[model samples]
Target chain A: MTTRTVARRVLTLVVRGRGAQGGVWGEAVLREFDETVTTWQALRWAAGGIRVAMRERRRRAADARRAGARWRRVSRRIVIGSATAAAVLAVLNQFVVTIAYEPSAGMQPTLRAGSRIIVDRISLHFGGLSRGDLVQISLPTPAGRISAFKRVVGLPGDQISCRDGFLIRNGVRVDEPYLPAGSTIDCRALTVPAHEVYVLGDNRAASADSRIWGPVAERDITGRVLVFS
Target chain B: MPRRPDTSPQTLLLFRALLADPSQWRYGYDLSRETALASGTLYPILIRLADREFLETRWEPPEQPGRPPRHVYRLTDAGADHARERLAAAAKPSASSKKAATAPTPRLLGGAR
Candidate 1:
């Protein structure tokens, strides 16, 4: 083979070893080699190539350091964002709607035992109470305050009485569609005073409510029931 | 692995070459020729200096078509100051050494007189 062929073969091998570092440096080396073809000059060019390979190795180490710093910054942002979302959800649950499950037959047919329900605590703050609205009440008992679910029957200043399995509101018979068929309600007449409401259960036959414990104060109502399953 | 530039003869020679024209862009091949340093010895020093921010690099476009661009380097502002301070500190003699050098030796008077 001619000297030029040999030179070309050597140059190709050296450039291949350059690999990722080959781009501009490789081209410069090849151009310089083409300008000088003597054996002595080729040896000098090989020496220069070795220096470039060492420089490339150091450059890779610096790039790794920069990448590590960027990864740490991204991880910190993710953790902060997740914590912020959890806090907002907690606030919404406390002041807005909350999910709960019915554990008794008090509000049956409308809300069966073990029914999942959503209570709107915010509604009581905006729209005030009204008759026929289902509510979660905190009833004061001898043991402690126990929570109960019932439908509002009589509002303040209304004469409420139960006669022959029916509800009497302000001396007028009121229709109760939520109550189970054939359920009987027998109780004496009593007027719900100011800031008080009479509440009752849908399963009147099996429930202990206003007839037994009397009317509940307006302050004892916890939340208005919105949805049930 | 990255390393700090040592105060070896080769390293000093390369630093002197760069410091001679602190602002001008110096090509790698030209630097190698001027300093009489092998590629293996010269490149590591340049890389270490650049990593420490004592040198800055740039790519200069080729003067002719079909020629690849060349990588050129120069001392950074901080690098020039650091090199000057380090070199000057090395050249300055310590107080004890300076006092010893200046102290006059007593002459043998009897035989000479």
Candidate 2:
């Protein structure tokens, strides 16, 4: 309505310009306005103050935009970092090896219970299978499907038999120090079929093995036990 | 290093005004009148100068009762030196014509839209 009133409103705008920053400048301009001797002078001062306020508001908006961009970069880095880690682990598990800790319920004595073991998937394809090596097999049990570690004792065409507390393969008694001393696990000398091997658990008393489910095919044996850590 | 503010005509005018009394505290209103700068243009330069440590500011008690305290500013030693340097450089011949200094266009603040 009046020049003085308009100047006063403009002074308010100057303080609000700090809405764009900290309001120190706005206060500075406001305090100066109080010293203006005429309404005309005050109006002129307030016009200038408005421009300053708009500049401050624009400056603050830029700062906020920069901060928003920084946050986006940080979140993107977190997401990309997690994704890369998961992919590397998946590749290692599929092609290199699978690390597992097993409570050696079936295969024991040699592989102590509660020890950590690594299944060597790479070696399963490279190295030839032997009669005394420990292997990981996926086969069926009475309850359901099972993943187990067992000792290989009978190769293809080998007649495996248990006589006098020892495991005899093709009439040659194999030295099984891992089995409990003088433990007799009765397995009739059945000829192992081609592409298969007879496997038995070292904890012969508690284990359900080839004696219960028959020999496991070579394709069914997934990996060889590399180490008991 | 502290960032240097722009060297427009208004900014040069302000430098000349402050250089007249380098150590004495200059009031914002007096500066606007002395330099013929709009309060809008005069203040942002003052705030920038203070922010860059080229100038120091203080609040002086009013001369009379009921009058609010005035915000006063004075150039620092660095600001005085810089002001002299800018004035001396502007005096020398340059690529641009002198008319641009007398009525320079207003530059936009913040980012371009």
Best by TM-score: 2
TM-score for each model:
0.48, 0.55
DockQ of each: 0.17, 0.48
Per residue, candidate 2 scores C-alpha lDDT tens digits across A87-129 of 9987775567787666657776776667688888766666668
lDDT score of residue A147 within candidate 2: 79
Clashing pairs in 2: none
lDDT of 2 at A75: 100
**Where is model 2 chain A poorest over a 10-residue stretch in terms of lDDT?**
A13-22
lDDT: worst 10-residue window of model 2 chain B: B104-113
Error of 1 at A18 (Å): 9.8
Per-model RMSD to reference: 14.3, 12.2
Query: Against the true structure, candidate 1 has what lDDT?
Result: 0.74
Q: Give me the displacement of residue A156 in model 1, in angstroms.
A: 25
Across all candidates, what is each one's fraction of true contacts kept? 0.32, 0.82
Per-residue lDDT tens digits for candidate 1, residues A1-229, read 7665565556546655546345344444444455444666566666565456545645655788889989999999999988999999877765688888888988888889999889998768667789999999889989999988989998999999877778899988888877777877888799998988999988887777899989999899989998888
lDDT string for model 1 (B19-105, tens) is: 787889998777777888865567667777887889898778889878766778888987876665444433443634334334422
Each model's lDDT: 0.74, 0.78
